[model samples]
Target: MTNYDEVPYPDFIHPATHPGNMAAIARLHGVNAPPPESCRVLELACGPGGNLISLATLLPSSHFEGVDFAAGHVKTGNAMIGKLGLTNIQLHHAKIEDWVTHPESEQDRFDYIIAHGVYSWVPEEVRQSILAICQMRLSANGIALISYNTYPGWHQRQMARDMMRYHADGIEDPHKRLRHGKALLSSVAQNVPQGSAYRVALEEELKALDQANEAYISHEQFEDTNRPCYFHEFAAEAGAQCLQVIAEADWGDSTYEQVRPDVASALASLPKIRRGQTLDFFRRRTFRQTLVCHESVAVSEQLQSADMASMHFVTSSSLQGDQITGSNGLSGTVEDPTTRQAMECLVAEYPASMSYQELCEVVETEEPRSLATLQTDLFNLVCVGLVSVSASPTEVRREVSSHPRALPLAREQVLRGDTVTNLRHQPIRLDDTTAHLIRCCDGETDHAGLVERMVAYSMANGGLVEGDQVVTGEESLRVLVTAKMTSNLQRLAAMALLVG
Candidate 1:
């Protein structure tokens, strides 16, 4: 089995912030003031606390207890809980299967059991043990989420893994292994035809990755246990305990698009088997964090899709602050341009939020239904960071940056440079001319003083300032500074990075 035991788990972004979880939660339970404070969420192999912490932040009342054998990760998570001041979460430095199944244990049955990144990592015995615990500890109507590496998708990844293994065989150093793997791929490009499907796809993926910033890539690839799963196989394993798939994380992604049209169509044609097969087919699924439930309880014959867009948005693992629509959060048909446009507008103002009522108004839909109409739009808006949910009307915030990923890398650049001193991670990428403009944010510098400095900087450079500046005149310059400063402030507030 390739001995993945030694591989360190990927340093994944916490699941609380995971789009998959956010999407799944929205699907499982709406912002609909959950069932009860007594409901317990049990997570297995909850590495380093990102997922649990994020969920804790979202639902302050729920009791979340997670277990992992990786003590170091538990310690790191404990530190984050202290930093974040989350009170409802508890971390245990033991494997969950051991803890739950141990004799003399006093803990009650759990209402929700989430085991993401588990089934594929541990050996089959450990997985079965975990399943047995879920069956024993889960309450009626309880949900036990067990995410594994699904098949079809696993095929491509294994091909990539084969390449990696072939390139780095017998290489003990992790750095050397990584470099060797990447270098070997680069080497093969020279011999391969440029336009071939594999060649073209690999090149484009590499280029897109190169364009991605350091934090983004590090968060993505440099993990310990990034493995794949087989769909039907994992479901069959879970079924041992009467646990079944209720839905997937980013549930809509589990829709027609991720699956082949014919496959989806064929599944749609069948009844229980097709539904069960679709639930089982996580093989092709790249990253899954599903929401599972008891075989008898949560699967209702009602067949009500509460809100796909909203559920997907909050559960989505993507932190780009992009908006989503339909199925997951609030439901709407994208075939309707008003619905699409409404979602675009909401996402267009991320970190800054839009009211459900206001969104419907913007889409030009009629009154009463407008609120209902905007529901899905707002749900989708949650995915991309275009909108945030908050308590009060005045507390809402917004940002106008077109390229969000560039912001972090750009802020680092601004901080390192001597010209933009006393600034600590603000600008969403300021050009040299605009760089001079952002210093005005310190509150000491007035708008006129900023404009004068911007002009002086522009004059020094040839028509454009340093690092891809455009010469559209002072009016444009003022607009750029004002717009970015406003956007940065809003984003900072959303992240609690700013005061006042």
Candidate 2:
């Protein structure tokens, strides 16, 4: 096992791991669980604490504690917490086994436990320990999220991992190992004759690896312990620990509509758990983020419209005339007048969420529709990844301050040139101008001040229109700067970057 201190995993947010999202899914399945607003959260193997930090910032009432063996990650994460002035979250440098023995006193049990990227890559003892922590330390009606590599899907990826590991053996330096691994893959991908299945597989694997970060390759593929198991086997292990899987972190995977009709019919014959296992085989799923609760907790296998109606819905889609299109690569057009009207209303309040009842009221159909129909429409939108359902309502600060206050975590990330993770847990890559504008949103400048600073920064850094027509008049430049600032602020609000 490689010490993560050498090559730490990149700090990123996983929305599926968010307690609100997880709890919402659990509730939809008829499991009584704690609300995310003020729950206790525990994260195993929290590297640099980016995911937890994002959650803590958004849900200030919730308390978060992270435990990791790597001291460097803990230190860096703690430093970030201090800089952000957030006291609700803390990171400790300790092994999972050690932490379980002497848990924090503020909360004896956590409402949610997250172990992302830790289950399939650790030793058997460590894996069992993680489950034990969830079983023993999880609060009554708590939900635990564990993500791992699944077999059939990982069966192909394993071959690639083995090849990379074999080529990088005896390499001590992480960077050198990564370089050697890439070169080895490239050599094999190029030498294999065309039209060969082996060549095709290698090329496909290479293409996927090309987009991954070096640290990911080093720790994920090159790590000593990488175990991929069948979905049933994982479920059995959880059952042994007195835990039962309630749902997958991804809602689409849990629904059969996403699968072909014939395949779905075939899977319908098996028991629910077995059906999931068989579906894995059909889909060749490589990874899974499974959500579990104590076996004593009763959970419904089916989702109800009432459950969805109780939740709030949000989407980043744009409506042009009667058509609603998603920016997140969600396919299909929404043209039904009722659905279209609801979607348009949601889009108008971008980055904010509307309750199902509110949506119905706003649409005010002449031929009043049942809650079931609205629920189905919203679920369809969610299935296409165009919309998200949340247990809590979104809090947006529409009033731009004298110096508008952006999210503190986002401000820090922008200054450090890292991708900004929004409240939705989606990463946004900002250009130089946008990044500067975000940094300026520290709540010190009013609208005029912001425009003035943006103009000065733009003029000093070679005005807004570069390599194109230049605005000669000072008055025109200021007006252009003001309009640009307003548009940028609106865009930021849409991106969920503004904080109340």
Q: Per-residue lDDT for 345-376 in model 1, tens only?
A: 64454434445456556777675554455565
Each candidate structure's count of clashing pairs: 57, 4
lDDT tens readout by residue for model 2, 1-500: 33788788888678899887898899988987898999999999999998999889889999999998888888889989999999999898888887555345537789999999999999999999999999988998999999999989888889888987898899888888878887888898799899798888888888888887767777888888999999999999999999999989997786575678888787877776898888887788999999999999998876655678788888878777766678765556766677878888898776888888899898786464644566788887776678888888887765555567888899998876658978777678889878888888887778888888788877777667735777645566689988777778878877888884
| CA lDDT, every model vs. true structure | 0.51, 0.84
| Poorly placed runs, candidate 1 (over 4 Å) | 1-10, 14-39, 102-107, 193-227, 258-266, 272-284, 298-484, 493-500
Q: Which candidate ranks first by lDDT, i.e. highest? A: 2
For model 1 the TM-score comes to: 0.62
Query: lDDT value for candidate 2?
Result: 0.84
Predicted structure with the largest TM-score when compared to the true one: 2
